[model samples]
Target: MAFSNDVKIKALVACARCCCICHKFCGIKIECHHIIQEADGGSNSFENCIPLCFDCHADMLSYDDKHPKGTKYRPDELKFHRDGWTSKINAARPADYCDEHRKLDQGLFLRILRRLPWNGSIGFISTNNFAGFSFDCRALLDLHELAACNDDPSWEFIDPTLEIARANLAHHVSRFLGLIGMNTFPTDNPDRNSVPEEWERERPEHFFQVVDEIHEAASRCVDSYKTLLREGRRRLAIESPADEEPTSKPKT
Candidate 1:
């Protein structure tokens, strides 16, 4: 069969959901433009299409015009394929983020993190496998940007595998917390409305306060361990345990 009708509908739905990148961002317009011009040798394929701001489409067609009267593109331009989140934005994205952010591998927020004089130690806790935790970093960076902008979406997935990856990652986070004694977070409400309800009334708090307390307890335990280590080091420093202080014979 030719291009699936569902695919085209997906493209259109994405455009409307993001408002064609028109409403939220500067460069995006409401049209999905073919990266490789349809006239040359391109076919109706997902790779050939990208969501373009209206002006970008026109600018792309005219790119060669800037060079000369009979100028041409390098063969690479015709066959090029951008990868990662950038490609996702071009293909389609959540309604909240702009095309510019979507097209980024690390997106805009991490770009700022990279630029800083110090490498920020942002700890991401998730499953070890790429299949499990790959999307967490990119999604987190995007969420950081969203918060900065004071707007966002419920979720973002860069790859089809991302959904499964996230579920596994959540498992890891839960397991890690269990090891440390913190418990389920956010709330017990099935709907997660953030409203107080009867189910949570039985629980002390609807958040991870116990988790914080356990961490503090763990820190104090380390001090006792350190004292043992220091005592051992002092004993090791002396050739013997001072010869057991020479047995004192009591003279009666």
Candidate 2:
């Protein structure tokens, strides 16, 4: 059964119209997801609802318990995330939105910037040839974690524009990761790289097509991140360093 209107409204308000998982300000692009599947006898109560963005909702449903790959977000974990976010939103005071509180945190912004991949991970994926390539999965893992950091309350920008830009960057990065599949290269060894078996045997044309798609997604991620950085710097009144911008794809 679908969530009732009351339940949906409550969830939306509690999450402040942002996604509970990524904490991105989704505006009207948010959805009420069932923490437990309806097929599993999950109810349509407010307690069973989770507010998520389109990408996060898809990710939550994509996990297959029967053939589990990566770590699945359990129902309890979803509840924890939802409850914690709601508490924060509810505890926020009106004065928190005053001009004094809207000042940008330069140190916080710098820390977040340091966590981003810059021209490293996304740059490599967008510019490299993926054929017969066993990508170092650790890089992707790091990127995912960096993107997920957007959900941390400490990362929230007081400026609405900056926060929106940050959310856009996180959304794009998460979308790119979703397209690639987080555990696409599940490995027993942490140091092992993940090579798509099909890439080795598929027709050259087909392989190139897949590579092109990945390149496009990775490029979008880079663009979103660049936008965030630009907005962040402007909000913080910080000048960009000489080498702050991503350079052209490195010559092989």
Candidate 3:
């Protein structure tokens, strides 16, 4: 039996819409594949599905020895890839996606919450707060990458917030790089910005404000992602099998 649309969509999202074997982002349509072929009695469930772009899907299905480039993937190997990708994504994904994925997402969120700067004993510092700011910048960048790599329209909700956060972060990074007398930043980066005339070291207060804006934008973006995820999950659940129990976290 063919997997339900819910399972197929969930599998695509869980894998971040990239081919597991080739690890390439597909701009075109991806096909949902069965690790165990349906003809072999494989159940049409999330755990049994994998997402592959057309080329990779064709390669996987081709078992001809003459086609050396076409590597045949074992069912267990595909499952491992799915499980590993799911774990990585769960760290950054929201709980509204799927119940099977939510357990890991919740655990990762708790871990992130525990690491946040909430220590009451220490007062907040202003200048040269590179570590904390850099962490947030990297996180936003990761989310942006996820959206780009998946090419999924569902992630459009957070695009504007990401743009604002990236702009703010880029300005900060450029200012820092300029302080060290570097003339150029990465040219290919969409977020790269030139150091502005007003971004001098004496204007530390203004710099802090930019950082605050970045943090605020990031928080808003995170909330928006959670909202979209909840909506997506709700829609998926409406199409899901009623008796289906969400898969538990796979053994690590």
- Find the candidate with the highest lDDT and give its number: 2
Q: For model 3, how does the per-residue alpha-carbon lDDT over 110-223 read when each residue is reduced to its tens digit?
A: 332233211210111112232122222232233333333232322222222222222223323233333322322222353533223244366666555555454343333333
Whole-model Cα lDDT per candidate?
A: 0.34, 0.70, 0.45
For residue 210, give model 2's deviation from the true position in Å: 2.2
Q: Per-residue error at 67 for model 2, in Å?
A: 11
Ranked by lDDT from best down, the candidates are: 2, 3, 1
Tens-digit per-residue lDDT, 81-137, candidate 1: 223334444444335545554444223223322321111111221211111111222
Model 2: which ten-residue window has the lowest total lDDT? 243-252
Q: Which stretches of candidate 2 lie over 4 Å from their true place?
A: 4-17, 25-30, 34-49, 54-94, 97-104, 117-119, 122-164, 174-201, 242-244, 247-252
Residue pairs that clash (backbone atoms under 3 angstroms), model 3: none
TM-score for candidate 2, please give it: 0.57
Candidate 2 global lDDT? 0.70
- Measured on C-alpha atoms, candidate 3 has an lDDT of 0.45
Ranking by TM-score: 2, 3, 1
Q: Which predicted model would earn the best TM-score?
A: 2
Assess candidate 1 and give its lDDT.
0.34
Give the residue spans of candidate 1 off by over 4 A.
1-5, 12-28, 65-82, 86-252
Backbone collision count in every prediction? 3, 0, 0
